[model samples]
Target: MKTVADIILHNGNIQTQDGFHPMARAVAVSGKRILSVGSDRDILGLASSHTQVIDLDNRLVLPGFIDTHFHFYEWALNYDSIDFSRVGSFKEMENAVSNKALALGEGNWVLGQGFNESDWPENKIPDRYDLDRIAPNNPVCIWRCDLHLSVANSLGLKLAKIGFETPDPEDGVIAKDTSGRPTGVLKELASNLIRNVLPKPSRAAVLENMQKAVGDAHKFGLTSIHDIRLMGGLDGADALKAWQQLHRENRLHIRCHVALPGEMTDQAIDLGLCTGFGDDLLKIGYLKFFSDGGMGARTGWMTKKYLDAEFGMPLTPVADIERAVLKADQVGLSVMVHAVGDRANKEIIAMFQRIESHDRTRCIIPHRIEHVQMILPEDLEKLSTLKNIAVSCQPNNLSLDISMIDSCAGPRGKYAYALKNILKTGVPLMLSSDAPVADPNPLAGIYSAVTRKRMNKTPEKGWYVEQALSVEEAVKGYTITPAVASGTGDCLGSISKGKIADIIVLDQDIFKIDPDGIADTKVDITLFDGRIVHER
Candidate 1:
């Protein structure tokens, strides 16, 4: 006889993205899998005398949220670092760094994330002298909100040996003053100059951070996340190794779809790691490539010059990115390129057009152009063609990029977050908070998609109200679309029978709430594999 396992959730409005059951009252779980879902009485009848039954008390239950893109490692390491998440003035930032340095003592590295020059009134990137004046002996590194840029103090530059003679790396830039001296700021590849010199964290530290990040994800009601960047350099692949350790220990609570950086695309291909190389806990989803830099960093490849500036270059040239995409497709590995500008998206689409198969597995499996921010009107159609190409959009960008749009895009800023336009073209859409840059709050992200308003709540309606999505469409992007993007749509997207028992019970009916209030809603309970992981 088959031994029955424990637990079942009954009496709730289960919104299974599966459509068949728009609302289910109960669900049965055996061990880690969902055994059945139906009426309250039907599911409760499956419970053995030993089964644990949970009454949801009419709270709305749905598939656990899945973040299609995020940097889990970075988020974890930042917990101990200085937080500039809310610091407004440069004085405030300096004070924060000084305080952190005092706490850590002299000579300690004072690091922080979420410092956006655009957010400052002066719209200027701070330099080494600013920190050198505060913490003269400490090495301080403050990452720009986009993570594509970092401003280090004089001490940090000295610690990393970054001097005037330091030639710019092929793909990165070290900002220089008008006098051609190092300006204590680095962009993109240039960031590695300091990171490479810094001592790598211990394996124990990596594990600890990984656990903390995972726990945080669970509390946010995320049962799955696609670790966006997993590239390792001279450190001997610590990121991959740490993830494997977490998987082996069964400590990785949520499903993880990891990406191998473009630098290691060859290695991933040689190892025969396709889209689904591992079990539920870990899998090789795609090979990530950078076609252009990020938006806030002003490095995103643009066809025409930026409205305010004449200088901007693609991280990878048009020819090179296309060639890499074609080669990755030929090798049976899916490709995902970060293309934020209209030109970058067009160039990536042109490259994807070369892929010649309808087979999702062999040809071009769900190739993604991450952050299709300023997509061209004409090129939107290309998304529907090309066998496996989806737009992995970051809708929360509207909240963060509002100031940038006014300063950078000037008149063309209207197209910043075009969710409605993108979706209407019949392209599959997935939503994510590029965290540490934006809050990983799915509700906030969803609210942004539907409303397109920033923190100040301007625009009355939205930047491009015609492109705004419906509440249901936006929610589907967070739940169903992400699962589909990760190749787990059948098992994880919805609250359905025989699916993974990962679900979230929200405090209010998401659909019934005011559109603007959606972001304010709370997660009452989060469950993973039928086990309660977080409860308010």
Candidate 2:
């Protein structure tokens, strides 16, 4: 019996990402998998009268993008939150919060996020008094773009029961005024105090919002994501439950690999959960751990002091991380640690080396280092030696952090966001948006990676042009490399026979355009599971 394709896309420029057959003119999709990829004639021959054949008109088609580090649950819930991503000054931020407060009418919580003081003219961190002045009657809390810090109003702080008398929690900080009064600025775990006290949305509301978020993701050509867990482990269980609920309801259009919090290693082991535990639609991913905070917050556990002469702090001690990694490894669960500073990266690399030395027998999935945001050259060399290790970097963050890193790290900024250098070391480099921290659009990420510049195209020559990746390399970072990280390389990365049919058609050829314009490129069509999920 001849196998007939359910759908056929012909006369298209398809980037298969398979070395042997790197490019194809057409593709045939049967059910949820690719049935054939070849010249237009070959694929068109597989189409029967019932097949839905579409002429691509020479449009660019590529594998669907994969965001290896995304806070899906968090982003979905904050869909309606006030966006300060474009706010330019302290007054602008104040006005935004004030407006939200007035609209919600007193006593309701006014929550906002994605404010970066570094981008503001004032160049000063907002304090509780700043928020209190604008939203006095209503409790207000706004997060820094990096999410490593947050500022709340006095009412918000009082509601969380945090005051000068309250001591900082482990791995967190409560900034204080000169008079020793609470300043409403919380760092790391301290922000969780307010988060825990905030009223959560109902499960039904979350699911509805998540479905909308999935739709938005499809617009950006994202067909898969590694739904990352936040620090403090507050959202891990809920996040996993949400994804599972979406799956059970038959509403999960995008593939997801939900990570388990490192703190829950024992529970996962007891439940017989390991990496890649579920089906293709969803699976258990890495055990997530944090080695330090973000660079923007000056809490990234650095080897040296910042320009302000302050050394960053570690959220989790190196020794503690090593112990957890070893324990998780013994149970066949890979770990992904968030390391932002040079010291943090160095420590994590050494820890992974130690693990490899002790246990070379287990068939463990490749462990990962998230946000290798900053690292020394020697550390990069050391990282390359670990055969079972991969890296997930956020180019979108590089666009957000260029100015902040230049100001904080100064000369050492040369080593920050070295995408090309990291690639040279022979380690698998997966690109991601780290969404909610930065924009989640893969094109925006690709632009930043290739241009090493902000969306505005500043720094005419580009930031450390030496570190920029080529277009093909950046695309690989979002495609082939992420597939390897998620342990789905054989089935999800490329447009090959027998692989999952997750692909997208672009309105413009990103590879052929000027790198600066890549950020503005749009996805004209998106196909997930061999079905057209989105059409522009």
Candidate 3:
């Protein structure tokens, strides 16, 4: 008996992202997998009377995007929080917080995120005093755009019990004034002091917000994400539980790969959890480790002193991370280390090389370097030599970091965000948003990668034009490469026969449009597991 397709989309420009059948005019979906992909007539022939047949009207259809390093749990929880992503000055930030504080009433915590001082005209980092002036009665905390730093108001600091006498945590710093007073600027794990005190939303509220966040992700054409864990491992268990609960309730619309924090390596090993341990919708990803902080905070460990600042500090010692990686690797779990600066990337790459050489029988699951934001040419070459490693870079962050890097690194900025160069090394390069830190829209990321400019398309010639990728390369970074990174190359990344039918139709042909317009492109329809989950 001939298998009938549940849905047939014909007369479309389909980018399969599959080597064998890279382009197709139509695709037929059977249940939750692709039944056939061919010419219009061939695919339409697979449709039966019960099949839902639709004409694509020549729209561009492609594999659903996969964000390899999204902080989904954090993004979801901040769904209701104040957004400072668009604020242009300190005055605007203050007004925004003041408004929120007024609405939430006195003593109520006011939490917000996505503030980049680099974007402000003053270019001044917000401190506790600034927040205090705006919302003195409220315990307020706002995160820098990178999540590596946060500023809390005086009330918030008091509530967190942080004072001038509070010693810096092992991997964190609480900035102080020259007068020996706390400045309210928390870096790395120090933000946990404020986070630990902030009220957590109920589990039910988290699930509800997560459901909304899923819809928002679909709108941006994201069908899958690697839900990255933060440094302290505070949200690791809760994040996994939320995903599991969503899966159990059949509400998990997006494919998720949940990462375990490196801090939980012992616990994960004891529980016998390995990477790729779950079903398709949700799977255990890598054991996430941090080598250094973010560039925005000027805390990204660098080989040399920044032109304007001191050499940044390491968040986790290199030797400590290597030990944890070895333990996890022996048990079949891969590792993803966050390395943002040249020194950090060089050290982490060497660690991976050492592990590879010392253990010939290590797990096949590829370890990854998150935010290879800056890499010396030598480090990039070394990274390429590791057969069992991948690098996840964020172009959206590239859009955000260009000016910051230029100001801090000077000539060394040339090696930052070297996307094209990294690809030349024969290593899989995955593009992701690192959401809540940067915009999550895959289109925005693609725009940044191809244009090497902010959304407004600045500098006219583009920054580090040599690193700019072609439209095809950027698209592949979000599609096929991510599949390869996640060890799901065979089934999830492309539109091929017998592959999972996670696909999206775009309103415009990104490949044909002007590069600047790519960020404005929208997803017209999203098909997840062969079901029409979103239409706009």
- Per-candidate Cα lDDT values, in order, are 0.78, 0.91, 0.92
Taking all chains together, each candidate's TM-score versus the true structure is: 0.95, 0.98, 0.99
lDDT of each residue in 1-536, candidate 3, tens digit only: 13799999999999999998899999999999999999998888888889999899999999999999999999999998999888878889989999999999998999999998886789899888888889988999999999999999899999999997999998899999898789999999999998898888999999999999999999999999999999999999999999999999999999999999999999999999989898889999999999999888889999999988799989888999988988888889899999998999999999988988985646667899999888998888898898888889999998878778988998889999999999999889999999999999999999999999987788778998999999999999999999977889888899999989999999999999999999999999999998999999
Question: What does candidate 2 score in Cα RMSD to the true structure?
Answer: 1.1
Clashing pairs in 2: none
Candidate 1's TM-score: 0.95
Ranking by lDDT: 3, 2, 1
How well is each residue in 332-427 modelled by candidate 2, as lDDT tens digits? 888899999999999999988988898553535788999999999999889889888889999999888888998999989999998999999998
Write candidate 1's Cα lDDT for 1-536 as tens digits.
Answer: 12353778888988878888777898778877888878988888887889988889988888899888787666776778877767777878878988999999998898888876676787777888887888898888889878888989988998888888888987788999987888888888888878877766777888888888878887778888877772223222556678889888877887887777777767876777677678888887777777777667778777777777654667867687666666677667787788887777888887777654424346434778788888777778776676577878888867778788778877677666778888887878999988877778788888888888875566677676777888889889989887776577778888877788888988888788777777887888888877889888
Residue 191 of model 1 has an lDDT of: 86
List where candidate 2 sits over 4 angstroms from the true fold. Answer: 361-363
Candidate 3 lDDT at 216 equals: 96
Could you tell me which 10 consecutive residues in candidate 3 have the lowest summed lDDT? 356-365
